[model samples]
Structure formats: structure tokens, C-alpha cells
Target: MTDNWSEVDLVLKTMVSTCLANEKYFGDLDSVVGDGDFGYSLARGFEKLQAQYDELDRTDIGTFLKKVGMLVTSRIGGTSGPIWGTGFLRAGMTAGATTELDGATVVKMLRSAVEGIQARGQAELGDKTLLDALVPMTDAIEEALAAGATSTEVVGRAAVAARSAADATAQLVAKRGRAAYTGERSRGSVDAGATAVAVIIEQIAEVWKTRESR
Candidate 1:
């Protein structure tokens, strides 16, 4: 089964829950280069997600996601939230209720997501930004799909790629976010936003896999 709106909700819930569960891990790491609010922002976003769900009962994924995006932007005060908020909004626009979140959809959504972040944050791949992980995961998912892998397999591959890309950012100069202030010192330091996004996407993909297998 392709990932549906219900699956999207489940994935977001799981990702939010995982982020909350590992809040200290993200907070501790981000303290090195960020405001250390990644955990808080993510937790708030997840809580806001539940609020969005409660406020809106539309089965239309697009409507649901647009609302989600707006809520994230409003409730979460951070560059990451706006960046991710736009991504989710684009996803809603590109993907509707009839969509199954197939390989092509995932590729489009990922591309849109990165573009949305870049557009909002003025960041790019290799910029020690979320784009780093997002770019690679998108490519990996496409590759897995080209090889005829199932959604679960594609997600597994994407997750591996996301992890590698997140690690790679540590070696790059920060060109966006607070890390940009550190210049060369930013090198060898993983980006807080990238790491957070990596965790969210991988967790979401895993949830998607579980839905597929069920």
C-alpha cells in the first residue's frame, strides 16, 4: 500500500514522538552551534500537529497539510520550522488524497521540500543545511525506485543516505543558519537543522514502511 493521508499523520506523529524521546540528544548537540531549541521546536510542532488534526477533519491531504504547514510556521518560532513548513505545504500541493506516495511522489516531494527550504532559508546542498541530508535522501529514493524496490526498501535506502549526508555536513562550512557565523570552525560540526531533518525524514519513512507492510 502506498502511503496515504492516514500514513502521513501516523508518520508525523511518530517522528514527533521520536524527536521528543530524543530531545536531549538533539538539544545537547545543537547547543554547540545553535540555540538548543531544536527539541523544543520539534516537540511544539508535534503538539501543534495534534491540534491541527483536532481542528480540521478534512480527509483531503492537501487541505490537511496546508493547515499543518501554517500551524508549524505560526506555533514554532525558528528558521527550521518555516523551512519545513513550506516543504509540507508543497507536499500537500503536489500530493493529494488520490496519491499513493509512490517513488515518483516521494522524489517530487523531497525536491519540493529542499527547494522550499532553500527558498525560505537561502541555503543549498553542501551548505551545511537540511538540504544536505534531503538532497541525498531524495537521490537515494529515486535510485531505489529505479531499481524497482518497494517503498519500504526505498525508505531504508533513503534513511541510510540521510544519515551519511547528515554526517557529511560536519565537514562542510556553514553557509546558512547560526552555524554560518562560525565559518571554517563550522567544519566538523554537524548542522543542527540538518540533523533534525534527517531524524524526522528517516522516522517518517520508517513509519511509511510499516504502513506498507501492514
Candidate 2:
């Protein structure tokens, strides 16, 4: 029953803030096997979003998200830009002109975002990429809603699933992105992008829980 663009805006705002706050942590995770710029790049992109947030078109959820996607894509550095940007863009496309979003629509939007990321990054579920966490997170959200969970419960379950999946990436060898270049050396460390997803979801869950109480 989660509806309205303001709620969506709040979620996005939380995501942006979470990314900014975890910039150093994410960069450290990436440095284990990547170029160590994952956090920096993501933060820089979200910074632009934060800066222009108030100015974004609120014509509809779709329009607002599309603008955010475009801004992130153009501003973020390295490969993170296109990958993260595509996720947002595809979600926006799926949302279309909708002003209110139900649970089912939210799941659909997440599925579309995951597909877009897969296509854009040429990645799969076990690729040790963000998909590892994102796919499970989306699935958890769908399952939670199907089971009649409330908004807070749905996001809380998603956060747990994402965290578990992201942690499991430590056992996987990178198959894509800069981390892949490290071969077996990447097996010991978690994927930065996947970890970021988990952290963001956890923050969103907390925020949603607080919102629900009020």
C-alpha cells in the first residue's frame, strides 16, 4: 500500500545520504581488489543528485527518477556511473507516468532495474557484481509483499537478504569489472558494489521503519 512520490523521494534521499556517509568504507572495500575508486565514484555521483534534488522535476515519479539517473550517469566516474545509472533509468522507465506506486509496482520496478543492470554490465547472478546482492534483495521484496508484509517488513527482509548475498560474494571470484582483473586474488574480498547495495537497503529499511512508526 506504499503510494505517493513523496515516499519514493524519501527513499532516494536516504540512499543518497547513505552512499555519501559510507564513501570511505566502500572505497576501502574496493581497494582490496579494485581500483579503490568505487566509493569515491559513487559518492561523487550521488553528491550531484543531492545537490540538484530540490530542482528535479516532480512531474511524476518516473520523471524524477529519470532525471536522477541522467545526472548520476553523467557525473559519476569509472564504470560505476553507467551501471548504477542504468538501474535507476530502467526503474524510471518501468514506472512511466505513475504518481502512486503499489507494492507490486515497486517489485516490477526493481525487477526492471535488475535487468537493466545485467544488460548494461553484462553480468549475471553469480558474477560477484552488484547483481549478487540486488537480485536477492528484489526477490526478497517480492516474497515479502506476497506474504502480506507491511512496508517496513518488506524493506527489512530485503536488507537482510541483500546483506547475506553481499557477504557471500567473498567466496566468489570476480567475473566482471575491475575486480575481475585480480583473478583468484579477488575471492577473499566482498564486492564493493554489492556491499553498497546491502548498506543502502539496510539504511532504507531503518528509515522506513521510523516512517512507519510516525
Candidate 3:
């Protein structure tokens, strides 16, 4: 499977579309434990991002990803903006001028993204934040890759683990963000941010699976 810049673009577009489609659902989930604007922020940000998609430099994935970070940071709201923006920016830096990413490269990029989020958010595992989903998913991908799994398998495994981790957030006590204000009340509700993380990873896995089949 040739996971080139064009394929990455398609994957990003898919992520935007998917986030738009589930906007209301995300809002509803956030309403349970947060300020309830997570969906609107994500939808609006991605909409603007889609408008500027063609402006990204296609020759370098690093430039494209950095552009993505800037756009999301400028347009998105709440904590999602900075967290996601930092992640993409760090990933872009790690990618440098590369136009294509093999499995190892993908692992490195994702690890950088995770590290960026950690540095920016100051959150860790069991924080009832996106980290709850991202960290586990990244670990799953790394383990799969270490076991000689195919790219498709690695992404698929990560997605599945991310979904489960997102779901597990409902069982965790709030420790960060607005959810922390709820204290015990935050329990039993899914985290919108974690769900968003799962959704994007799932979309990436889906894109890769389709690409590999072709």
C-alpha cells in the first residue's frame, strides 16, 4: 500500500467529514460532563480546515500537517484546539519533509503527537481526557508493529483499542478540564474528547484498509 501524501489528504478529509457527521452526538456526550460545545468547535474548525485544504503544500506532508495544526488552532475552540494543534505540529516536525510514511514512520509520528499532547495538556493516563484513548491506542499500535504486524493490522488494532479506551473513560473519575468540576458526577458519561480521538483513529484505519485492498 502506497501511503503517500495524496492518501494522507484523503484520510484527513475523511476525518473531517466523519467529525461533521457526528457533531450532534459529540455535543450530546459533552453535555453530560462538559460545556457541551465540543461538537460545534470541532465541526466549525474542520469546516474551515476543509476550505483551506487545497492550499496546503502537497509536495511535503510535513508542511501539510503543520498547516493543519495552524488552521485547527486558529479555528477550533475550547481545549481541543491547542491540544490537537500541538499534536499535529509536533507530528509535522517529526515528519520533516517526508512525503510518505511507512509503518515505522507512522509509529514515530503518532508517538510524537502523543508526546505533544502530553506536554501541552499536562494530562496523563486515566485523566478522563483524550489521553485516555490516545496513549492506549498508540501503545497498541507500537506493540502490533513490534510483532511484525502489517500496517493495516497495526492501525486496526490501534483503532479497536482506542474505541475500547474511549468507552472505558465512562468508568473513570474526572481529573481534568471541565469534567473535573463535576467530580463524581462525571462518572458514567463518555468523554467527548476521547470519543473524538477514537473516531479519527478509526477513520485512519478504515482509510488504510481500503487503500491496502486496492
Which candidate's lDDT is highest? Answer: 2
Model 1: lDDT to the true structure: 0.76
Residue-wise lDDT of candidate 3 within 1-214, one digit each (tens)?
2357666877689889988988998899999989999999999889998898888776688888998999999998988899988888988989888777876777788889988988899888888999899889989988998899887898899999999999999999988889899999999997899999899889889888897799
Location of the lowest summed lDDT over 10 successive residues in candidate 2 = 1-10
State the number of backbone clashes in model 2: 0
Worst 10 residues of 3 by lDDT: 1-10
RMSD to true structure for each model, in Å: 2.1, 0.8, 1.5
Better of 1 and 2 by lDDT: 2
Q: What are the per-residue Cα lDDT tens digits for candidate 2 across 101-207?
A: 99898899999999999999899999899999999999999999999987888999999999999999999999999889989999989999999999999999888
- After aligning candidate 2 to the native by TM-score, how far in Å is the CA of 111 from where it should be? 0.8
Q: Find the candidate with the highest TM-score and give its number.
A: 2
lDDT of 2: 0.92
Write down the RMSD of candidate 1 (Cα, Å).
2.1
Which regions of candidate 2 deviate over 4 angstroms?
none
Give TM-scores for every candidate, taking all chains together and pairing residue i with residue i.
Answer: 0.89, 0.98, 0.94
Query: Which scores higher on TM-score, 2 or 3?
Result: 2
Candidate 1 colliding pairs, count = 0
